[model samples]
Target: MDWEVHQNPERLVKTFPFANFREALAFAHRVGELAEAKGHHPRLTVEWGRVTVEWWTHSAGGITEKDREMARLTDLLLG
Candidate 1:
């Protein structure tokens, strides 16, 4: 229901589940395209039935509104 916040290097992470690898991979690709368009990329781990996305701001030195917005946009990808 919410993102997993990480410490050390601050980040907002979430996991999207799917029935198969193709679905997850497709979702990851969409995120990649979105990242390219926004010029803000996240760490994406595409597995057999899920994709984990982590967003954070490097220049800002922490999690910022941009990271949250990217996570929001990522949710929009499903809608």
Candidate 2:
């Protein structure tokens, strides 16, 4: 999945590369839509050519199965 697991906060992070800023922004928007529909949100950083997505459960204070499922769904968004 090419996702990195970070400690302390304990989150799943992944960066998706796009051809340009417009594409990256669109991806971020799509991710936002997904988050809203699922009632779960992630931290998204959209740059000129990439979007970084970080998923974690704040209430649980760490990553959870839902976060992993969301990450998998996020990958499917690119495909």
- List lDDT for all candidates, in order: 0.94, 0.96
**Residue-by-residue lDDT tens digits, candidate 2, 1-79:** 6789998899999999999999999999999999999999999999999999999999999999999999999998997
Task: Kindly report which residue stretches of model 1 are placed more than 4 angstroms away from their true locations once superposed.
Answer: none
After best superposition, candidate 1 residue 28: deviation in angstroms? 0.2
Which one is best on TM-score? 2
Q: Which tens-of-lDDT digit does each residue in 1-79 have in candidate 1?
A: 3889998799999999999999999999999999999999999999999999999999987799999999999999987
lDDT of 2 at 46: 99
Instruction: Note each model's CA RMSD in angstroms.
Output: 1.1, 0.7
Clashes of 1: 0
